[model samples]
Target: MSQSAAVSPSIDLPENKSGPHTSRLGLITVVATFGGLLFGYDTGVINGALEPMKLDLGLNPAKEGFVVSILIFGAALGALIGGNLADRYGRKHNIMLLALVFMVGTLGCCLAPNWQMLGLFRFILGLAVGGASTTVPIYLAEVSPFEKRGSLVTRNEVMIVSGQFAAFIINAILFSVWGEHEVIWRYMLAVAVLPAIALFVGMMSMPESPRWLASKGRKQEAFEVLSQIRSPERAAAEMEEINALSTNGDSRPTSSWKDLTTPWIRRLIIIGIGVGVFQQLTGINSIMYYGTQLLQQAGFTSQGAIVANTLFGLASVVGICIGLMVMNKLDRRVMLLGGFVLTTLFHLLVGLSAYFLPESAAKPYVVLSLVIAFVFFMQGTIGPLAWLLLSEIFPLHVRSYAMGVCVFMLWITNATVAFVFPPIVSQFGIAPTFFLFAALGVLALIFIGTMVPETRGKTLEEFEDEFKAEYS
Candidate 1:
């Protein structure tokens, strides 16, 4: 193959390979995914706990929002620092480090005495969430076979939603039994610590990312790691591919800022950012973050809305599973386009129904149906696809920094939407809130259709060749 051809190479794993280590990869996935679990629990715990949390903390709309959104801001900062840390310390080491942060953040939140303390702890929790979000998927993607990469990395998302569901159920049971006990929120926050411990313990047995090892000139170590996961013949071949790409590939860029100064790199970063923003702007988090309280305002009681909120989490989990099933069978660009278009329609219908209907018997179910549809479409399409694409795009040399910057923008946009959602619904009503999300959804569809390229079935090196073709 020509050098340019080698730049964007793809491979098929051997049809009849077996090993002691196949299950080992699955084990590693479970370990790394604890980050996702903690993220889900920490973020979603507030949904059910919000009512009691508010009354206990004396929260008004603005302070409540700040308390809710503080973690996202912490996540933004965490991504920035964690990306650099992973790049410097190695993926495995930083993952272990992040688990400790997760524990501290969770414990802090659980022990918080007031809203101010809660915000402070949640910010710390965001750091862990952001770190895991960036690191875990990349770790899984790097370690997984391309044939199985999409499905494996998406487990992180599945775990995330599952954690959310567990939180809702736990909160419901606790609330029902305890009925406004002084510290019910603590139980909700404290549950997250289990996942943190799992992440830390799991990392103790996991190997470092072989690719990261190779990037730093540890070829022998890379081959050793690869051999554990691949058949001997396959492992040897894989190493050759990595060696060719990393050693003879494009010279490593000195700074991430260079991607901004350079045209192709800049465009790729922009596309990645669009994916991140679109993923959030679909209003998925709106349901996850405020599903209970928002539904209560729409006419359900506190307990009723929370029980209803579980359905969104459940739908999202199921949708992403279907998405993982279709990943290798379909192109990512198609998923993004089709998902957003349907999501746009759903949001519009929900807004119109909520707007026109009296706060009668039918309106809450209608809004609930719309939220369910949005979550389902989001998970099956944009949810898993966005995360997979972000992990795949960008050159290996600049992947960490570029991903950090893009995800930073993603977190900020998420925080902005989350912060405004409660107040917006309070001021303008549910119909208008859904209407605004629908408008942004339309813009996102246009952006994805025009700007984002298809990345399915391509190798990382081959994707780089695309950079030269598109902007060279």
Candidate 2:
């Protein structure tokens, strides 16, 4: 084929031809998605650990907010710089480095003598969390076969929630076993170190992303990486496509911020940021980060709340599993719209249950069920879709940078919500607080309907051309 012909919008290649290739791809996915697992455990551990940590450190509500939200602030910075690092160094290197940071931060939190020290360590951990959030999905997307891209990329999403569920279960076990110990929170933070070690050790044998290698003019290495994960025929065909796309000048290695100033790129960035911001505005993290507190306020005792919050974590894991099963089958835009609608309705119901339900013993259960439903819809739809779409929408050259920016904003929004939620609930009550989320959910619905594009069933290159043609 002519170079230009090979650079056409799409190319067909063989399907599922090599068992070894599929196993290698599966292994890579498992190793790389350790980042997602760490992201979940680190973030979710705080939900249950915070109460005991507060007691141990003598933290007031302000310090509690600071400790919870500081990591997110650091995450914003991490997401910003991580993309540049990945673009320059390579995805595998970036993730391995993040794993080390995770170990250091986890150890720091575990050993900290004061809340301030814990906050400092948590901020360090946030860097890894932010980097993983941006890099893992991109790595998965680039490495996955086009037909299985959605499900494979979203496997990271499943691991993420699975990590959270593990943390919740672990925290409950620890709290139940050592509830009297002031140091239980330290042990909770310590569990994360093992996975970090695994990620670092596992990634040593993993290949660099072929798309990334191709972008950097490393065609031979790119083909070698692809050959490990694709049938020989398919590998050669894709290498041709990657080479043609690289040489045609349609997608250049992003040199600096100047390259992303084009109108279409700007539009993609906006859409990415909107998707991320809306995902956070669903108040999902508020629940994830403060589920115990919310449960306590709703009427559960401290131990009871800790145990009940596991249910939320379980719902998250289950919901994302469902999302993965249908990830390739469903249209991205439709899933996003349906998720927002369902989550918004659940938000309203939760608020109403808290507002009008009398102080009977059943009120907490009612509110809990509604919140669980909200989590189910949000995780299955917005949770996976936000990261998947962010990974998919950007051009190869700017994928890291664009995803970093969007996730940076997403973390910022998450920080804002985390910092404010306690005060909002304390001042205005849970009803009003969730009602506010419901209001934002309405706005999110509008944004998705108007701005988000359908990305299902298209190769990254094809989607890029289609998006540019329509939006540029």
Predicted model with the maximum TM-score: 2
Residue 170, candidate 2: how far off, in angstroms? 0.7
Task: Give candidate 2 regions above 4 Å deviation.
Answer: 1-9
Candidate 1, residue 391: CA error in Å? 0.4
Q: Each prediction's Cα RMSD?
A: 2.7, 3.1
Residue-level lDDT of model 1, residues 1-472, one tens digit each, is 1212122245443532767778878888888888888878887888888778888888997888788888999999988888778777788998999999999998998888888988998999999889888888778878886667778888988888888888888888888899658678888788888878988998998999887888888889999998888778877877777777776665353336755557888888889899999889987887899898788878887678878888988898888888878877777777788999989899999889888887788889888888898889888888878888888887766777777888898899899888878778889988888888889998998898788877666666666666657686
Model 2 earns a TM-score of 0.97
Error of 1 at 268 (Å): 0.9
Model 1 RMSD, rounded to 1 decimal: 2.7
Candidate 2 residue lDDT tens string, 262-362? 89889888899999999999889999899998998999888889999999999999999998898888788888999999999998898898999999889
Q: Report the Cα lDDT for residue 285, model 1.
A: 85
